[model samples]
Target: MKWLWRSIASLALGLGALGVVLPGLPTTPFLLLAAWAGARGWPQMEQRLLRHPKYGPVIIDWRERRAVPRKAKWMASALMLSSLVSIWLLPAPMLLRWFLTLFLPCVALWLWSRPNS
Candidate 1:
């Protein structure tokens, strides 16, 4: 189980790192997942994440206060919504469009509900 969690964290961190360069990919969420998983499965990785210069503060804020910076929230929301809209408008399958339609707004609501860090 621990190894499974560590693998999940590693994969999430890789994707999050990639998200740094990808236009619509979400960096913070995956990083947050990595940090959470690492805490249980890989303490060293957790420490490294918490010690990171840019991502650390955001993680700390979330862990300490369940908050997210307003700028991050807006950016995440915009990217999520725009991606959803694109999928909705494109020739994607009905199931994918419907899933996104239901999912993205819930994500937005959760994001917006977080207190600003």
Candidate 2:
């Protein structure tokens, strides 16, 4: 069980790291997941994440207040819009593009609706 949890935490951390560079990838949620899993299964990993210079502050903000930073919100919205535009430009199946079109906008809307911290 511990090993399984550790694996999941590692995976979440990997995704979170990827999110750092990729617009709309959402680093916070995955970092939170990594933190939760590490706390349960690997304290050292949790501590490492907490100590990380870049990722740590965002997690701290979320922990201290259920607040999403204004910059993050705007970046996410922009990315989602860009992705939606890319989807439209691509010659993918209409259904798939439509699904991405609908999904990304809703996500952006929800992110925009969150209170600024």
- Quote each prediction's TM-score: 0.87, 0.81
Instruction: Give the C-alpha lDDT of model 1.
Output: 0.93
**Among all windows of ten consecutive residues in candidate 2, which has the lowest summed lDDT?**
58-67
In Å, residue 8's CA in model 2 sits off its true spot by 1.2
The residue pairs in collision within model 1 are none
Candidate 2 per-residue lDDT, tens place, 60-106, comes to 77777767789888877887888888888878899989899778878
- Model 2, stretches more than 4 Å misplaced? 21-26
lDDT of each: 0.93, 0.85
Which residue pairs in candidate 2 have backbone atoms (N, alpha carbon, C) closer than 3 angstroms, thus clashing?
A: none
For model 1, residues 11-89, the per-residue Cα lDDT tens digits are 9999999999998787998999999999999999999999999999999999999999998889988888788889977
